[model samples]
Target: MLITIENRNYGSFKYKNSTAYVHYRNSVVAEVPIEGELVPARGKINMTTSVDLKAETMISNPNFMADVTSGSLNMTSTASLHGKVSLLKIFKFPATAFSMCNISFFILTKSIDSKCTSKIKL
Candidate 1:
């Protein structure tokens, strides 16, 4: 499966070395170092990047659904399922405050992977 994540005003978090991992079935499939994090209010991180996730190997069952095992983003840990909006919330970011962050989600069955690019603004 393939997934994409992105948003606006995503260059304002105070993380010098940001790292994130996306896992499925208790196995880490993708890992990336986001340059920075985005914070709207107090201690909230914003995920405003076009992160594309694809499955490396294809399963025999074409209707197989991916189960997100765990994900560590910007030092925060979470357990989010595939195709769930709460996955974004697991980052400890307030969805109500940064509504204009422009987060988009896309999924395509092919490879199991994820992509994240951090843009920090000081």
Candidate 2:
């Protein structure tokens, strides 16, 4: 996924603290935090990250056949952002924070002809 930020305000905005996390079935799969940056007015930036679907341990368990046969996966993400406004390039106001959360579900399927083979030599 790509996170795009655009600064449309008059003054430059400083991003103090920013973090993102991905969760699957209430389990955290990936997380990242970015360094602070000053964004000039009219400037834009993009951040990118991805989660690993193969990390689902239940998929490999025979007892969890229901989950695999269902052929669906649910995931969620939470993002936090803290920002401060710069006054005259010297003084700064108190930092304000915001958070966003999202949930998504998708179908999973396997190819019929796909196969994995291993070779060993002694």
Candidate 3:
């Protein structure tokens, strides 16, 4: 694995209406939740970015770093997934010039429960 992720950027979730995003390896994954009455409304999970792969040549290929150009991995959440806690696990594999990776986990935030009903992995 031995992969390093820098330029870490993140945002907080709103009480009811909010968005959360995680960006890694030039790609972004997000889970959004709808806002309700805080205690009486229904919450839903929406996908703004589904762990889509975006090549950051600088990281994917060392040659791109030789130019000394600056680049960024940006992720924006459309809505907030408000629960008690959230978790992310990454698995990496060596594949030629590029690395193959996958993410898996369960997030239990405020509205989220331990029943393992709502889950997202990419």
Candidate 4:
């Protein structure tokens, strides 16, 4: 599945070294690591990435497949800010940041049969 995350924060704060996860019944099915600045003040950053699912893992957990097919899979993310200061390009300040954010959302799948029709009849 293709996962896209957009940061809509309108502040000086930025998200760095971020990671997103796909969860099924509280277990992580996939993990995607993201690096770079995400969304600026009054601006937007769209990051598109993907994760691969193991067939063995899915087969072992029948409920995971059921949730995916039913479009009930959930996604979550956690990230911290890049807090570093430099002065005159000669001196650097230590980062003293201890903050993070967690966000969650659900993935929904739509049936194509409701939108399009098959021309070839079997």
Candidate 5:
């Protein structure tokens, strides 16, 4: 299921990008793209965010579906954050992002693979 562990701004920060992926039995079942572009926030910055990733659409994997239906499925959701939130601008300190989670694609940076094994519209 799609779970948002963190929603409150905690204060404004920025990421090059982020995405969500559904995996079953070590296979990538689908991708949920997080939309945004790089924008410099003003002296003081804030961002409102929510993922469009849907839990209902996570039925593309038959085995997963069967397990889930049978109440024998073992599933977990994880999140990784890699940005500074010490200040509203978050960029006050000089640092580089070392990691993030569920980023399945990218358009600007060549750092991520811009393709997914499969996709289902949500």
Candidate 6:
């Protein structure tokens, strides 16, 4: 599965050196680092990356597993993210966000159908 994490800095403090992890079924499907990067206040960290997730890990049926890439898998899954938010590049705090995306993968379309709405805990 290809996972992309976009973190938004809503507060006035700058966020830096954060890492994003995509969790599905209590397993980490994707991990991306926000190293040496900065998200200005009221700005956002945009990252595009891909991770290889085996079909067997997600699907138990052997007959349908082989056709995942052939546009046979049309489904939606909920994913959560965990990362660090650094203040002024000094103090770091843990941040958690939940993104709800409607996974609609087709044979001819490439579109990101996820939207994240989060409340960072201090």
Q: Alpha-carbon error at 13 in model 1, in Å?
A: 7.9
lDDT of 4 by residue, 1-122 (tens): 33333333333233357555544445666666666553434455566666674446545776867766666544333333354334344554433223222332334533221111111111
lDDT of 2 by residue, 1-122 (tens): 55565665555667765666666566666675655778676687776655444455535545446554576444555655567766578876655434344543434533222122221111
lDDT of 2: 0.55
- 2, model 1: CA deviation in Å? 15
* lDDT (CA) per prediction: 0.32, 0.55, 0.28, 0.43, 0.38, 0.50
lDDT of 6 by residue, 19-115 (tens): 4554444445445454444445566555555455554555654444454557644443453445556666677776655444444445456554554
Q: Model 2, which residues run further than 4 Å from truth?
A: 7-11, 49-71, 87-91, 108-122
Highest lDDT scorer = 2
Model 5, total clashes: 0
What TM-score would each prediction reach against the true structure?
0.30, 0.54, 0.21, 0.48, 0.37, 0.46
After superposition, which runs of candidate 4 have C-alpha atoms over 4 Å from their true positions?
1-9, 62-122
Evaluated at residue 102, the lDDT of candidate 1 is 19
Candidate 3 residue spans exceeding 4 A from truth: 1-14, 25-27, 31-33, 40-122
TM-score, structure 2 vs. true:
0.54
Error of 1 at 53 (Å): 2.0
Candidate 5 CA-lDDT value? 0.38
What is the C-alpha lDDT profile of model 5 across 1-122, one tens digit per residue? Answer: 33223323333334444555445445544454543333233333334455443444445555755665554433322323334333554334422222224433222343433221221111
Expressed as tens digits, the lDDT of each residue in 24-108 for candidate 1 is: 4344444544443334322444344333443562222233333221222111112211121222344432222111111212333
Clashing pairs in 2: none
- Residue 69, model 4: lDDT of 67
Backbone clash numbers for all candidates listed: 19, 0, 12, 0, 0, 0
